[model samples]
Target chain A: MRRGVLAVYQVLLLVLLFAAWHVLVKLEVLSAFFFGEPLQVLARIWEWFASGRIYPHLGITLLETLLAFVIGTLAGLVVGLWLALSDTASRLLDPYIKAVNSMPRVILAPIFAVWFGLGIWSKVVLGVTLVFFIVFFSVYHGVREVSPVLLANARMLGASKRQLLRHVYLPSATAWVFASLHAAVGMAFVGAVIGEYLGSAKGVGYLILQAEGVFDVNTVFAGVLVLTLCALVLDWIVTLAERRLLRWRPAGPGAAQS
Target chain B: MSPQPALALHRVSCRFDARGGGTYVAIEDVSLSVAEGEFVAIVGPTGCGKSTLLNVAAGLLAPTAGAVRVFGEPLLGLNRRAGYLFQTDALLPWRSVRDNVRLGLELRGETDADRLADDWLARVGLGGHGHKYPHELSGGMRKRVALAQTLALDPKMLLMDEPFSALDVQTRALMENELLALWSQDRKSVLFVTHDLEEAISLSDRVVVLSAGPASRPVGEFAIDLPRPRDVSEIRLQPRFVELEQTIWQALKREVLRTYQRAEA
Candidate 1:
């Protein structure tokens, strides 16, 4: 099938890329000190995994990402529904919401560190701050833009206010949230890594920081490689969840399909 | 015959705030009624506020003036005894066909919702498609699901706004025949609105024509004396049916021309 052929080409491309990188470094065309040797990076990753030294760091990062993504999405959904349904509230909060969303939210990591210390909570809070806005805007638009005909139809079917919220608002709102799942998850991962780099003794970001202090470029490359794999795992998990939850959507190049 | 009508809109006037400062009148001083178990179709020119009248009857829109009564009682909130069929796709895209059909009953706290939903799906000839989503089905099939969703509630009255206008000619005729078959079982008082004069004449016991808008009102009314168990495609070939169409088209044609002329001006 076409999909099978495409997969083979994808794997071939990755191999070609790695092979070219290995050959360039061995020929001294590229500086190993700056780029780091591909063999050493791969070996370093293998050693860390073989020794099981990277498990705690990887686990902590994933935990923070999960907690932040869940809390942020839930908060966004509830607040979005409230604002969309209440015209007065939305109008009153419009300017303030825009101002806060436009601010450089990553700058809050230092403040969070001061309040929550160098624990996991500070990183989680930073991740939550990053993930919240993406979900909030999506849900808000989704709820506000719900087809009026559907609302009228549900009303005609004897739907009470509570029933309307349960049957109509939540489902539509979640579609928008799910559509933006990738961006939110990526933001959470970035928040956790950045928060760790600023002030934390744990997580892969901390390991990379420690490696950089000693000019251990190979170790730094190894740490980044490990972190990249972890992100891939998280993204894969998100894709699985989106598939199960959004199966009703048409099959296309978006969420809600295989 | 019962003296009280099933639905009565008395001197209803709906005026909307225009884009600028002044008010725009949609339907002005329009009064209409549908007797119990009667099928009444309201035909009009484009933008003649035909849907505004239907929305008022359904209690989805409150008229700027006058009142709406249902079976002798003044409607306060949503008309609880009426089901609405919208012109556009109204089925919840996320829900399966059976779940969409069960939505109303579930909202009402009915315990046997699944059984009733399945039964209604069967009635609409979509029994095997209960597991499919709205987008997975054809346009006509989705409309059938919407019909099942509305009919499962078993409301005393039905308010349909050009429910079959979106389907193709063949599918539209098939849906019409199915609708007639369902309505004949126990004639629910129906207020069907459309711009298709042929569709209006074919499906209803009576047809009311509204003039072009700015302030639209009913300009004509005609009784359809076509016999029961009629096939919508076959009925158009009959001489009586043609005569009725010509008579109604005369009343409707001037309003249609007025709408076009105003648009060009």
Candidate 2:
């Protein structure tokens, strides 16, 4: 009964928000040129889907996002584990890593375009840069923070160095990495969109850029709404994976049944 | 012919470099031995470095001075012949109860790891709890899983560092009785560390006491002559148990006081 009430309240909130937006535009309190009409934006969205013009661009954007996420996560996991285990190398590279991470990474899109020639690789490279550091730092801290008692117990049980890495370090790091999945995925999407906006002929981001050039406010809003929906779908998938993989964790407030 | 001691620490000393500067001595010139099939408990004040001594015997920490021998052989790296029960929750949180128990066997590449793990879990009174993760279990249940995890490999010796200190009194006594029953079956040489004098006196064949730390060493040792097949709870009511507790506590009290004063200072 409580959950039913909550669901009703959620739908009510969305309805109220859209009604306010429509009222403000109709009253001319907000300029239609800037905010766009709600009905027109919704119709524009319907037209794109009905005509199937959005599919190709959506597919390109998603492909870039996925490729970047996979490559960046793998690179981060390997380097994180390697540096965490090797004290000398981690110490030697400490200042250099910080320097690289601190520099604004979004600026690399133009550089990547120059090198990868405005193809999917440039966008993928940008996405990988954004996703890599988030995963790398989380994994490094995870491996480093494994309980000393657990390590000692494993050693006493006769775990070799390789076995320790496989059984203890990797599993522990995986849990931390999963905790950062939502943020990492979002970063991957940001990288793809920003790269496309800067220099690209394909992708949902490029479609939005084209609409903006013609001052087509309705199409621009439609593109943004589509991207938002896509991000929500991706986040839901990540949540499902997290729930399945982390069954060992105690149920948190979000999972609590009323 | 006399059999060799299962574990021997000769003149073991550990000094840590303090965070600010200089050095701090954890344990100094602490020599001890546990004979084959013997249950020895080291009782001391809180901060007297009892766990440090156990770490030395387990070969997890290299001593600043002296040597450790296992079964008359010089010890190096990890003490492969001994199983250790840590004071804290050391079971892998990501693993289920049975998987935690299976860790040692898996590491050893045993072909029948699952079967052995099930048998050990049953031995620890967690037969149907194999599927539950560590976070799903109670504190006592987690400790039982840790015990099963340690013993699954069938090591020749056991080194437990206050393994039941975190448990409630009732659970601690029950676990103590279960441990005694298990120890009686094969009689593996055991070195148990704790600050509880009654627990030490009730569960051990001999009790060794260490002085207050900065540099701590054994101050006294006593042999417990109580009969076997004893229940830890009932044993406490026995006259001999009370006498042994008093004698050991008398020696331990002075050090405890000294440690308290040092902490306040």
Per-structure clash totals for the candidates: 0, 0
**Cα miss at A175, model 1 (Å)?**
1.4
lDDT of 1 at B204: 95
lDDT of 2 by residue, B1-265 (tens): 1388999899989999999999999999988999999999999998899999999999999999999999999998889999999999999888999999999999999999999999999999999999999999999999999999988999899999999999999999999999999999999999999998999989999999999997999999999999998889888999988888888889999999999999999
Q: Considering only the true interface residues, what is the Cα RMSD of candidate 1 after superposition?
A: 0.7
Residue pairs whose backbone atoms clash in candidate 2: none
Interface RMSD values, listed in order for every candidate: 0.7, 0.7
Could you give candidate 1's per-residue lDDT for residues B1-265 as a string of tens digits? 4799999999999999999989999999999999999999999998999899999998888999999999999998889999999999988888998999999999888999999999999999998999999889999999999999999999899999999998999999999999999999999999999999889888999999999997999999999999988999999999999999999999899999999999999
Worst 10 residues of 1 chain B by lDDT: B1-10
Using TM-score as the measure, the top candidate is: 2
iRMS, candidate 2, in Å: value is: 0.7
Model 1 over residues A1-258: C-alpha lDDT tens digits? 588898899899988988998899889999888888888989999998899998999889888888998998889889989999999999999999999999998898999999999999999999988889899999999999999988888888888888889989999998888877778888888989999999999998898899999888999989877777777777788788877887888887664232
State candidate 1's DockQ.
Answer: 0.84
Question: Scoring each candidate complex against the real one, what DockQ results?
Answer: 0.84, 0.87
The RMSD (Cα, Å) of candidate 2 is 1.6
Stretches of candidate 2 off by over 4 Å are: A1-4, A254-258
